[model samples]
Target chain A: MKIYFPNFFQALLLIVLFTGGSAAFANEKSFIDEIKGADAPFDNRSVKLVRPVTLETVLAKEEYQGGAFRVLARKQHIERYKCSSCHVPGKPVLVQQGFELTHGDVVINHGRKGNELSCIDCHNQEDRDYLEDKKGRKIDFDHSYQLCGQCHFRQKRDWLGGAHGKRVTNWAGDRVVYNCASCHNPHSPRFEKRFPATYSVPLN
Target chain B: MGFTKKDKAEKIIEDVLEKPSSRRTFLKGASIAMAAGSAALATGCMPSGDDSSSGEMQLRWQEYFKKHYRLMTQKEKDETVDRLERLAKIQDDIDVQIGTEPPIENVLYGYAFNISRCEGFMECVTACVKENNLDRKTNTQYIRIFEMEPGKLDPSTGDGQFYHKVPVENKFYMGVQCFHCENAPCIKACPTKATWREPDGIVVVDYNWCIGCRYCQAACPYFGRRFNWGKGEVPKEELTTKQHYLGNRKRPMGKMEKCTFCIQRTRKGRLPACVDACPTGSRVFGNLLDPDSEIRYVLKHKKVFRMKENIGTQPKFWYFID
Candidate 1:
């Protein structure tokens, strides 16, 4: 009995500490709830206290339209340019076999001089429909923001927080925002310089 | 009796009294004038052959005697709206829907302009003109987008009428409109109390009550107000039929008009036309009281400034650089 008594006291001490810690946590949670309830006066449309951004939340998958957020795949946008129609299923090598006949008119002026990226760098070799991320993960065309977010983290954060990107339909109701692909082309991401709308009045 | 001097003076006075200069004659003329005035008021100048002339006369009298929009009863407001709608149909041959939506409780409308995003597109201005049905004849544009060279924040130095292709190197764009100031000087300067700020922070002018004094226009430092020099000549196809009682309802000549933040649309939980028309997503508008709203987010997260902040207008509109 003497030998087990000290061990028993230690076990009891641990249990007390655990219960006290959990009780304090529960108290904190209820306090937050009380604050939220008090803040909302009429409709439950009080300003939500936004949590601080974390790497995990930034990298999390986006949910849109009651499904996973998606962008139109490259193949879908250009229906006329089908790889299966030109190249056979087994033939992975197509550069030497009359590449100029099909893609001669295509202009690829993207990227800096000498380090211009090729189509194969971002596109999946086996499946022409899918895009390959840096880690070789096949990504849906709709979730192209993910591919862009890998490099442009700041823009991604802004887009998520209603700072960047265009919101459509109504601002008061459902938050249906456009994806990065909707505004910019993946091959040419930079916005083109164009003539603006008609002027309000003639300049003096 | 004729031989005496006093008798002669009395005879001359009687002669003058017998003429039209007598007090009785004056009283008779005054009664005739009163009767004519009353008749004019009752029948509206001249009797018309039209079937709706009586109804029109009654409507005009009612409109003339109607109280300010703020003091009007619910029933009175309804009757006025109906009359105005009918008048629009008769005069312009266009169906206009005028809403009397009261201010939403706890909703103080706020606007945020993003300078970094605005490319001097003028899309917002065009959309605003079409939506508000501004007078195209005088080229009265409520929104004036200023193109400023970098390093200069002063609007005075910016050119509001730049015609060159935009996104000009080292130049930024900023748009200005009626701020709907909390301490609106226009309201104070109005000699007739024609203009006042609504509960939702929208400063509105009663078109019928304004006397073309231009006091409000002179009082405004931002030059946001516009005076109608002539009747607004809106084409039948161009006229915006959807309107509000205190908003875009077509104004008569010689009345002050300004942007009401698209009250007809905004009060119905829709965005202002400018906000919708902005291709660059430069404009943000919402209830300032609501913490979760987009305007609140922009106010909290962005570095915002009100134009002429030193004037102490306490404008609800804010400008920000990205």
Candidate 2:
């Protein structure tokens, strides 16, 4: 129909088309944005907050083996450090160093027989200071995790991944955790059963 | 004994009745209006010294009318938290810091308990009670450690009160608290909207908004909620001064409360008191969304299961064994 139309009608048609096109454009862009947003993963490191209470220092930490945590150094907390001060090479040490005198209360019951694994198996006999791994590699007292990691590799892997051991004080920031000895008595690894601190049947 | 407007009006009526003169009736009506005006004036100029009367009456009034914590603006939250701390100082003489830190963005908390590792020491129980300031008189613990036998994963079939020794022969220990379920039934059951799961997945209760109806208590299948039957009694010395508005500040009597995963500590990047207190290192808590977190490792690598998966609660809590 070749009927004449006012100029206003033509402009109105353009406005309608442009408005509808803009809406479609926005929807198309928004759909892509939604997909991208869903794909983007959130990282825990985005949290900048650190633990207010910590027993760890940056001076002594090893980034957890390919993990997102740091293991706190243990040597600083070790009692009777500098094993060399009390022991000479090829000499009996536990008695002379007052290790037995001071720790007279503790008994080493880790293995079935004491002969299977002696102090020198883990503790360096040649150098009373550094701990010895199974391969006779000298491990720093601070890094005794490497020593414990040998025999109890499963626990070591979990500890490194932060499933088997204790986190120091807080959960976030500079993720520093306690070494194996912090919870387990290295000499006597098994925990003793004891009475609960508070006991009440919660269920009525 | 306080001079209220009603008391003043009663006195004015008594004086008018004692005379009973008909001519003064019109004047009595006029005088009553005057008394009303004066009563308003008197109250407007009331002494500031009355503020010292326990400070609780004022706090209680504000607390009574407060909006649900989720609906409150930051400013309103701050005002209430300040009033609560001041009330504690005035009434109990204990200086408490009530934190109102909101959930961190993009973080969802999840907890994992190692069934193979928990030794039934109840260290978590002791730490939870001390940390949350639970009722000393009643010993209302939020976390219950059940001594379970083989093939019995249910709490009803277990013993929560084997006090003789932990890790009993042929038995394993299981600790149950609020799993902070993804689809929490308690939140759905609450008539007042007092309890809700935060963005971080830790279900919290606004202490003031709770109506003490205990509907949530009845609705929770895991027995995750507790009703304060009596006023929580913690010795002034034993009370934990560090508190959270939605956590273990000071619970009102008859409100439903459950484990908030130690919101005061957790929101600040600290582990829950129970996790920190465990001698066996069984409890693991972290951001659920974070793939590298210990909890995620436990979920992905270990044979893990929730308490009642068939109910479709989708609890963030999981139990695993070595």
Candidate 3:
């Protein structure tokens, strides 16, 4: 009994040390002060309590010296979307019959208003909108199928119809749905044809 | 008298030899389906080896790559075929054999029609949408049947891009859709393996799997596909909601979609609604494999051409000079 009692006490001591230590360590560490002394709200339930470092801060880090969010945004637009096809910013968004920028107008109006919410503000590394695969990753942007589900609910319906994305099921099985960004790059969405339809034959 | 009986036997043999089997019928129907339903069966079906006792098989992208339908492990493919059969039974009571075929390789399918032959009838476009179950609000048609000038190929060349008048003078009508290509750039641009080309050379989009990023739309040389900007309007009464899981399944908003060569209708043993709807027999569908088929004959002898042949996409859809 004496020998077993000492071993039991040791085991209890270790359990208390590990559990109590983790609990105390988890006691809301604040990093808002690290960045301009602002009080950033933390979700207690989540295991990821480390204060998020934004693109703004990542650029300020020693590793990312020349990374400017504004510049990156401009580059992505110029390189990816043929921005010149429509708006010159200072100029009006080009609009004609059949081709309208109505959707763009809504997004630009609601999504990007205050300078406070930049491009990366909603779409960044920590946005849990996609699966988090930071350091050891072969594929970048492991987006959750649900992330795009937040905005385009209707497409999600068509997706269920087997009309939109990659379908990985038997013809008769319960349909599996994919996320929006899987097939589309959210920045510049357009339909692509394999070949130019210059052959002007008409199907009556 | 015995010699005459031998001659009669000879005549019976000749009659049996002369009789044609339903295989010819099957071939004719199959050919029509390939072109019309290229979009629908882009993934679901391939011809398999004759195993009368067994049923159809489902194939994954990887398994599809390893074997043509005939060479596939029957156990694996049957699991899928059985599921499809069950689904078909649920949808309808007809004896539907989801037959398998060898994986179609390298060959691409495309179409080019003579606008001169087309009237103002929007049969082809309407047929495609109804056959594919497009969102009613968007009224999505994979092929855009446009009314253009007789001499001009581009619809946007001369007139105000949108004209309210119906059947304007000297205007030629053209149907433009995905030119199922051997090399599809849109497939390359997708971050996920959502949209891709099948072995038989059809570019198909998985509506359910699409992320609605629109990169594929931008990558395409022809703006054949469209995006669901909103929940497409479907009049509840008019919705022919029978969904083909891979074919004209209803599309959702934000995802990119395009014409899939009437995949749903063609995959089954039937003519595409567009083909059936055409008042003029302008569309010709046939098996490239069969030398005697009409399409094969046209391709071999006629001056067949496709859109953007210069890009080397090797489109299966073609147009003979009007």
Candidate 4:
């Protein structure tokens, strides 16, 4: 009983193999592409469209909360004001001129040996993220501290524990907190001008 | 305030005495100044436009117009230097070292920071903007401090250290700034000699000379320099009238800028803005030349480190863990 496969059966088997191979090849190529230019694309990483959309949907903002529209507004704000006209703006926190962050001596350890963060790595966005309020209304980026706590659980815990950044006591109660930029300059995060030696002069 | 020949001589003598040279040299300069002052007075007719209410009629020096120092037109450069000397209350007859002075050249200064002990108070940022006379309209902030976790390299993962309500706990704030390098890539990247390293290892940018190419911004390994997208927002009423020549001079449109370690203040025996602003005394600054300085002491005794030492910029600034 040597069963000869009909021409149709043979054709169907070929189509199945061809379609499966192509799909597998396509998937492999996508993965390969990701690995090949991974580091290079870091400089040109576009905002994740889906993630922001998802974020807006989850927050259910009456106004679009994805922050996609805010990028140009922020750029315009920077332009109109000329933030770098007097001092350098867009400088990373770690490398602004004439800045230092250590005292007399004795190094403090905060665990930056293997995995340290860059200014953009955390700041990620060029503009501020809009947050959701209790009434499902979109708030300004000024109130986006809660958005930061989403990923920085430890720092958030420390913040809650009274140890990380600024300490703004709520006028209403101790339960409320102010956002990060309240004290920190979001652009150049490091090398602050306010230090003990500069107390005589009024600071920015 | 019109000065006669006698008044001119007296002013010259006073200037010579104020310089750092020896008493003999000072006396010689004084004699020359007196002679020149007398000559101008003898010529008669004080160069009009005397604003007596403003004070003595100060002769604006011609030193700023020297052809070799910069690219300004004959008229522009002359006016600039004249304004400078007048601002400094110098008589035109006095031979100021403005252009004739030898350049200090590069002394190779840079900064290194210890990332562990900083409390993200932002005292430094505020201090710098004020001391440098940064334009407010632009919100020109020079420093960026990241609240980072232990053993982590990415600042993005850290909550910008902003998670702390006002002053948070546990996380260490790491402050980074221009590592004024011995061989600054920013300087090399500039098409003009607008930004250069000073003899004391500080890098300075000439706002007037800058073309706003922004190549230096791209070339800096530490991302130190910044560009002005618009005119800065400094209030006229709040401006610090007292300014240094290369330090915190009023800037113009479409130029690049950055921190200079408060050269005007620092060179005059004062602390940089950031060092003085740290409430925790987290930052310590001093002349590396002085062995007894607090900064030198820290460098010698503590385990100090520069950020990205592998880049080989040889920063003058140092950082230590608390």
- Ranking of candidates on lDDT, top first: 2, 1, 4, 3
lDDT tens per residue, model 3, B27-75 = 5466555534543453335445532212222212222222122223777
For model 2, name the residue pairs that clash. none
Q: Which candidate is the best by TM-score?
A: 2
DockQ of each: 0.11, 0.27, 0.01, 0.02
Query: Model 1, range B161-249, lDDT digits (tens) per residue?
Result: 77877788888998989999876899989987788877677998888778999999999988889988768887879888888988888
Q: Weakest 10 consecutive residues, lDDT, candidate 4 chain B?
A: B99-108
Docking tier of model 4: it is: incorrect
Tens-digit lDDT track for model 4 on A1-204? Answer: 246667778899999999988865554344224222223211101211111211111221112111111111122222324323333446443333313432123222222655544433433233323344334444445444444455556554433322333212110011122234444444433434332321111112
- In candidate 1, how many Å is residue A199 off? 2.4
Off by over 4 Å in 3: A1-204, B1-110, B158-169
lDDT of 2 by residue, B61-108 (tens): 556556668767899999999999988888888899999998997677
The most accurate candidate by lDDT is 2
Residue-level lDDT for B108 in candidate 3: 26
Supply every candidate's count of residue pairs whose N, Cα or C atoms clash at under 3 angstroms.
Answer: 4, 0, 58, 88
TM-score of chain B taken alone, every candidate:
0.84, 0.84, 0.63, 0.68
Native-contact recovery for every candidate? 0.26, 0.60, 0.00, 0.02
| Error in Å for residue B134 of model 1 | 0.6
Residue B153 lDDT, candidate 2, scale 0-100: 90
TM-score of chain A of each: 0.56, 0.66, 0.28, 0.27
Candidate 3 docks at the CAPRI level of: incorrect
Tell me how far the alpha carbon of residue B31 in candidate 1 is from the true structure, in angstroms, after superposition: 19
Which ranges in model 1 have alpha carbons more than 4 Å from their true place? A1-125, A202-204, B1-49
